[model samples]
Target: MSVPQPDSDEVVEQCENCAVKTPHNVSIKLITESNKEENTAFSREPYRITECSQCGAKTRQRMNDA
Candidate 1:
């Protein structure tokens, strides 16, 4: 059986205010990137911010593979 992969339609995270692992509003965008030839462009990854659907607390996260 194949493991179910996470799709763009899903939002998974823990809310500090609610103190539960619930679905949240995840916003992703490219913050900064490296232009050096040797450095991997993936190193300067995008920001995966999560917002609580309950209390609406925003949290910033560095997503390396996002």
Candidate 2:
């Protein structure tokens, strides 16, 4: 139940085409399970939530490997 987020000092952005600016209040939730990780709830944890302001289309992508 560990959820990550952007810093409070960070600013929210919107789609460039919309021309309308608003907070990225939208959320993208994701969880993945694999046979190899038998007992785990999710093998692939979502890293980031990307959202579109105008149409509200969203996507979740894995974070970069360190």
Output the lDDT of residue 5, model 2.
Answer: 44
lDDT of 1 by residue, 27-53 (tens): 897765666667665556778888765
Cα RMSD of all models vs. native, in order, equals 9.0, 9.3
Off by over 4 Å in 1: 1-10, 33-44
TM-score of each: 0.53, 0.41
How many backbone clashes are present in model 2? 0
Best by lDDT: 1
For candidate 2, give the lDDT. 0.52
Q: List the residue pairs that clash in candidate 2.
A: none
Worst 10 residues of 2 by lDDT: 1-10
* Model 2 alpha-carbon miss at residue 27, Å: 4.5
Could you tell me how far off, in angstroms, the CA of residue 17 lies in candidate 2 after the best superposition? Answer: 6.0
